[model samples]
Target chain A: MLNEFFENAPCGYFSFFDDGKIFVFNETFCKLLGYDKEALKDRNVESIFTLSTRIFYQTHFFPLVKMQGHAEEIFLSLLTNKGQHLPVLLNAKREEHGGKLFTSCAFITVPNRKKFEDELVAAKNVAEKALQENSELLKAKADLQQHTERLDAQIQLVNKQNSELKQLNHVVTHSLKEPLRKILIYSERINDKAQPNILKLARATKQMRVVVTGLQQYVWLDNTPSHFTHIDLNDLAEKAAAQLRQELNADLLNLHMVKLPSLEADAEQIQLLLYHILSNAIKFKKDEKAEVTITATALKQNIFRSVEHKYKYEDFIKLEITDKGIGFDPAFKEYIFDLFRKLHDTEGHGLGLALSKKVATNHFGLIEADSRINEYTRITVLLPLFQTTR
Target chain B: MQKNILVRNNVKVFGNGTQPMLFAHGFGCDQNMWRYITPAFEEDYRIVLFDYVGAGKSDRTSYNAERYSSLHGYAQDVLDVCEALELQDTIFVGHSVSSMVGLLAAVEKPEYFSNLIMVGPSPCYINDADYIGGFERKDIEELLETMERNYIGWANFLAPNIMGNADRPELGQELTESFCSTDPVIASQFAKATFFSDNRKDLFKLKVPSLILQCSEDIIAPVEVGNYLQENLSNSTFKLMKAKGHCPHMSEPEETIMYIKEYLG
Candidate 1:
């Protein structure tokens, strides 16, 4: 029974007689490494196993089996037919039978048993990376949605405004028809008794026509974008002066000019922009004379200011309009360039300074306002010179 | 520059060739409100349709509360239209709130208009001594609250519309933009100014020939009040149309147009 038990163990087992020689090996041990039991039988241990493992077996496995009588569950590496290493655990013991010393070993592969643990770690890493990517993608999608919504809203608002503007134009234009017809009819209907009022009505209708033209011009000028064209500076100044001649009593302006230059720019916008600035100067003119001077200089050199986003400019034209107006405090620096920003309750849209800045920016230049409270205001405008390259 | 008796933005004789009729629409509508009624009278009368400032297609920039607060402002608007058009010796028609506006305009310049026709008239909104204006300040306040709540509701309602693609509209976004465009505060204030206004006292002193077409079973203008007006008005006719609801022009257009044609004839 004892011999049968020793020979028929579940795993490969073996015993040695204190010598580096195989005393016994099972069918299972040989099969585990893709070798036949008979082929490995009685083979020198060093030849069948690798040298390092063979040395370890001789030194550790032999001593432990010989001295301790048993060495159970030890890890070891074994070589296969293809020269690949195999992880394994060995069990062995020192034994004495019939007055003979012997060493025995038993083993099974271990790397296969570690598969569950490694799979757990890999799954954890994958989940963490997927979670990070999902959140980032979600955030990016949300930001894109918000941007699209805002743009769509702006577009819709613009369309609605355009529609209303068209309707307004229709109403205003259609309105002129009846009044114009009445002027023609009533002028013919007047006799001596009703002649005075009738003639007055006719005159009013003609005046109405003038008012309509003014309305159309105001709307047109307000809507047009700042497009560049050949502009006459002196003409624009004089035109503005003429436009406000009736209201000049409010400002009591004495417009004077130094030698000025005319060039290509957004003609209507520049006209309007200058008009706004000059008007603001007059509207807030100090106790001094409401006199304005216009001058120009060739700004060919580069300007190095301590500001970010330096302009890639090759040349420029500098124009300065100085007015002895009730200038604002210097503390309001750059505020004049803000749209609808008014420091005083003066007449006209608060677009004067803002419009000037817009024109300056559109010209690939900048505008600076230098002034002292209750003193004088100087508006400097820089214009980019056009260039061509081969 | 020949300023007459300052008849509230009035232009006396605006148009020629047998002075045509002029129409003034109520809030939220332009002269296009005249569309349902004008064609009935267009064969015989040259009709004029114009929007008021801050409403419909009128100049929104010109909207100032102090200038456009009362029927007086609306009356001024009528006068301005007449002056702008050079209209004269024509019948004048007004709807809803503009009904009182037309009456006041006629009073301002009697020579400019042959008659005044007021549709779906309401003289006052709140009840006072021997008078029923049909609405109170609290009612208008509640209306404001309702509008505020409704605006929020509408925003949520339209969320889907804006969120979904342009082709596949989400119902949510559609409602939100529609409600968002109409400022709740403005609509409430406008409603209070509209529903709570009182212009009944001006009726007893009417000088021009006038026609009042009141809708029967109207929540805005009750039938009993219409009868009471017929008894009290000095030179006016109160004819109740066979229609229900505040706006017969929307629910029963043909009946409303027939009544208008009858009065016009």
Candidate 2:
């Protein structure tokens, strides 16, 4: 029976001398490290791990084994012969073989680290990108009073001219939207269309969008469009929450919403923007506590007339959504909106925030964030309110 | 079949006597932990020794997650062997983690074991109102953090290691390198369970006649914890091993085995 087990045992088992030389390497360890019986017998423990980590093992880990004579279930990385790391915990005994001491041990490996790291990075990149996009929008808003002044001077004093300018601005902004969307689509499509340059083109398309937003008057809010529609902020809140709950697994989340007042504006884009922010907050949770709140209220419609976004913005409305959960590195705040940028090695980048940013700005709105790591993150969306507020 | 069951861990049954005695190893060590103590019992007893799933020579693949996350999983493994062997009126001997495991096994299946000889058993790792196990939550947390940072093969990362931990100097780094180890996740969970688990209830429910060995300066299982087990376990005799550190069986094996023989008599 012992012979059968020695050949086909489930867990890793082996032994090493106090000097960190291998006296035994079991079938499991051999399989995990992809080493042969001959290879293992002659290998010193130090030669098995990589240089940076081998030194660690020599200084910290192996010494403990000698002193303690044994250890149980310690999670650490082990390097295989082919140079791949195996995460394992070891339990050993101080064996007296003749006059010298040795460690007789066994262990098991977890294969979840890489997967977890990927998920963390992807998710982080997406969140960071979203926040970065919001920052760009805020920066645009700050440049607003100045741009509005310059543009106002260009087409001031003539009502007919102002109306004509509005039509041109509409055409320019609306056309920019499809092409921008097409850029993102084509870039992602390039992954399959031109696989070699997928990463390069992907990066290009994202950078191109930033330049477009920065170079041109990103948004041209009409002063008082006849087509302005009444948007029920409460309805938008409910819609966003319903969709977010479904996306993030409602059973795992604590979502709360306050009755919000209505404000009329670009309903389609406003709805789309809210949905993205809320969904994002929901996606970032992993066994940690998650909570989200979305609330909106009418802003006094007069701020629009005073605001003058390059001579547009006939209204003002504010919507707030707050999430308390794992946050990101502040150092990457600028890179958050960059496509393919990852923070925690999880998944996805740039799309959520870029799309949300586009929807908000194209609809004559602003979005910004105030965040601290492992703490609360608040996103504020400022949009133009329609005259008939509910 | 029962011999085969433990054979995967290289646990050989030595000696040729009718009265069977099982020796359980402690944490940080394996069934080989009973090497010195078993020699004394061999002449008079049918000696049994086997490694726990996480210990020496055991089948690493056989270590089931849902199964071996707690000490009771080990207890069940002991019972499995006892049932397989059809051993009765057996004297159960356990060291460190296995001591508590043997106690739990005896409580659950008393028919096989007549007396449990617990060498350095700790019911809990925390200092409760009455018990002082010489470990604090922070201390355990630091130990766990140490494993996460150092002991586990955290740095030999495949590629693009996490900037924070994959680089920083970890606590208990020295302890981590001694041997081939288990996965970090399992190690963390095990540490939490071992250090934080409160088995005061298990002690209260123990029924078998037992001998509780307490080492004078055992870092892992303190003297008070042994006394606590003795106080709770009726018909249990308590003796202080004149030694220190976690494994008295390794440090002072001669005296440790001598005390066991006297307890048996």
Candidate 3:
């Protein structure tokens, strides 16, 4: 009765020698493997295992059993005679019987259990992937928060600086202006050998007043709020050129202006931008004839202002103003954009190009200068065709 | 300084002889795997065993993901253990992936090692156009899945026992201890590093004489791989063993020892 029970047991039973040669197995084990007793003779236990299971058996399961004498509840898949994988829950124990050592193993086929476990593992993997993605999103949000906070702090600092500059502008316009007027009037009244020196002093004071006024205009650009509207660049360029012609009283100021695309920008600021650039070309002329040409092209590209700031624009109008004049060294291309930077010590307070850059920046644009010594100097202004309300 | 390195890797030194024989374990296990093979060498050579940082009783806190991400990191562990013990002319015995690890160490510092004994070693596990590594990428993925299921089973088995000894935390330590206990995450990373790595290019850099002990039916390192290694590695002796599967040092230690002794003689 015990022999019949062993053969008819629900779980498959097998015994292998320490060298992995199978010596005995139950009928149920043979049926599960779809192999006859004769066919199973002289076969190793690993012969029935799939590739991955054989690896697991050799690397993990075999080692565990050898060290701990038994391994329970191990998951492994066995290959049957018909070449189908049969997932099984395996329990193994190393035993010494009749002065010889061998291993006894019981296998319970668990197809349903294996399927459920795989589903659970798949779900767990999905959850883990979701958690990883969520954490990455949270990190990105935190970085953006940090960036916004830094920008807010920078804006507050700029506001404070602008208010302080406003106070300085008030002092220069009111307090310094009255004293300079007194000096010029008193110098003109002097009638002696000192009269020539007095005239020189008055001329210096006049130049100081022009510099002070230019400083006021430069500071005002930051204080005033910009009002953007659709402005025709052709009209603005003509008006600027005509004004320069009237002011310089020189018909030799040749201006070849191209048809430019109308873009949404601050009309007043753009007008100032055009006037400053045209005036610089005329002021730094080689001789009496000041020849300037303006051309425009539309581009879809990115504007790189600095390493940290890059703005992508779908549509941008690039305006190039080239002047055949006595251009300064190309090294001072960026330096010429500073408020008090003058390369040739010419007439004017050296704030023209700086004011032009300020106006272009306020309109979300970039102005760059490319020049060569005693050749043509080209000033390129790239402005976005469309403006978003700030 | 030596004590810190020793503790970090759980370095154990024992022998009756003067020359050092450093044994490096492979993935999925620790230095305890050498127990079956180390006894034969204990009388004739100094036996040095160490758990690579994240495995066994070594310092788990020192497991840096970036450092242990490649075989080079494990190679550094071998070198560190060598430097700490001040071993010279060492006969290095490495099993499985540690074969490549030992190769890297010997290539980096050839002065410290004299011979490399590799058991069931494969330079690459994934097959390419010209080389057959005996596994597809899919098979490795399945292995990783199986590993995860087993680790989960272990965790589930330990959870209740851990909760029962919540008041006695010291008892919890013993309850959690198991043979070849490796951190599951580190094991997975180690698996990726081992199976996915291609150290074929590093074979030419080996200056030390070596022995390749290829098992009969090793799915991990097939006979073709052993032949490939013998052909590629200069001044190397290849021996095909009767023992089947990987880990011949454990399964057939007597034969493993005889080959080492013969080669050393």
Give TM-scores for every candidate, taking all chains together and pairing residue i with residue i.
0.35, 0.39, 0.59
- Cand. 2 TM to true fold: 0.39
Docking class of 2: incorrect
Q: Which stretches of candidate 2 lie over 4 Å from their true place?
A: A1-390, B1-4, B7-11, B152-183
Write one digit per residue (lDDT tens) for candidate 3, span A156-183: 9999987899899899889998998898
Per-residue CA lDDT of candidate 2, range A1-390, in tens? 886687668878877764456887677778888888888895666566544344234323543444444445545567787788676656555666787666787777666754565466567657867996798689779788777887778657566776776776665557765787797887776547656677777776777665445323323223433245767766876677677667656554566787765655667556666776665676665345458777654422223434422222133555667788677766665565544455655444445565566655655566666567887667777766553442
- TM-score, candidate 1, first chain: 0.41
Model 1 residue runs over 4 Å out of place are: A1-390, B1-18, B151-186
Question: What is the descending lDDT order?
Answer: 3, 2, 1
**Residue A355, candidate 3: C-alpha displacement in angstroms:** 49
Specify the poorest-scoring 10-residue window by lDDT in model 2 chain A: A305-314
Flag clash pairs in model 3.
Answer: none
Compared with the true structure, all predictions reach lDDT values of 0.61, 0.64, 0.83
Give interface RMSD (Å), model 2.
Answer: 19.9
